[model samples]
Target: MRMALFSLVATVMALGASPAIAQEREQVKLVFEHALPNVEGKRMDAVLVSYPPGSKSLPHRHAASAFIYAYVLSGAIRSQVGNDPTQVYHAGEGFYETPGAHHRISENASDTEPASLLAVFVVDSKDGALTIPDKDATPK
Candidate 1:
């Protein structure tokens, strides 16, 4: 009876540890790259964003930030900002986000292959910060 109880406790502890290890592994996958200041007044950070086919970013805003340059390296992306309709960008094309644009939405195209993009954020380091979505865009 005591051995049985200990076995149950050990199984519970192992199950709990699995989720914590999974979360840590997910946190490790995010990486970013930065560039030197150029003629532009903003600092640049580049990130390789990957989305599983048909995945999307939640509607997010950067009200205090100025510009973002998204360059497609592989696969396709559709982007929507503010009240505008979603727009598609193929491999090799680039899209720019304006200052005070307020919202950005992005998604992958296919369901079989992953989409990849190089996102260059030009930010006013003194005041720049990302604003993630707080509410759902589509009405339920």
Candidate 2:
């Protein structure tokens, strides 16, 4: 039937579009997670965030109870927390974010080179998600 054929075409087109959307965002992978034996009800989570040349993440926040430390692993990363001025961090440099801080900017500093960072989070064990993108945020 024509209806079934049209539905199949639409589905195929949608599937093809998904990868382009995914390619625009940075990649995040959990590298480690463990309960903090010395800190009651706290857990530590470490994630490696890879940014392809010129890629960036949307405006987002971490768990409300999370305190984060981010260290540049390779290349340079541009970052801004809360209302602070944007700063570019090179490999070996790092920064921290207080609990509930708004991460307004995060991107690769160079268009020709890739970048990466290790983000270590200290958060309550009860927190469900590590990163929460803002509802109204869109990729640039």
Model 1 TM: 0.64
Cα lDDT of model 1 by residue, 1-140, tens digit = 34633453344334331111111001111134243455355565555566666566666676367577766666787888778888888877888788778556677766655566666566776644544454665422
Q: Which residue runs does candidate 2 get wrong by more than 4 Å?
A: 1-22
**Model 1 lDDT, residue 6, Cα:** 41
**Stretches of candidate 1 above 4 Å error?**
1-41, 135-140
For candidate 2, write residues 5-60 as lDDT tens digits: 34433443343311222245788877668898889999988777878787899999
- Which 10 successive residues of model 1 have the least lDDT summed? 19-28
State each model's CA lDDT, in order: 0.57, 0.80
- Leading candidate by lDDT: 2
What is residue 98's positional error in candidate 1, in angstroms?
A: 0.6
Q: All candidates' TM-scores?
A: 0.64, 0.83
- Cα error, residue 94 of model 2, in Å, equals 0.3
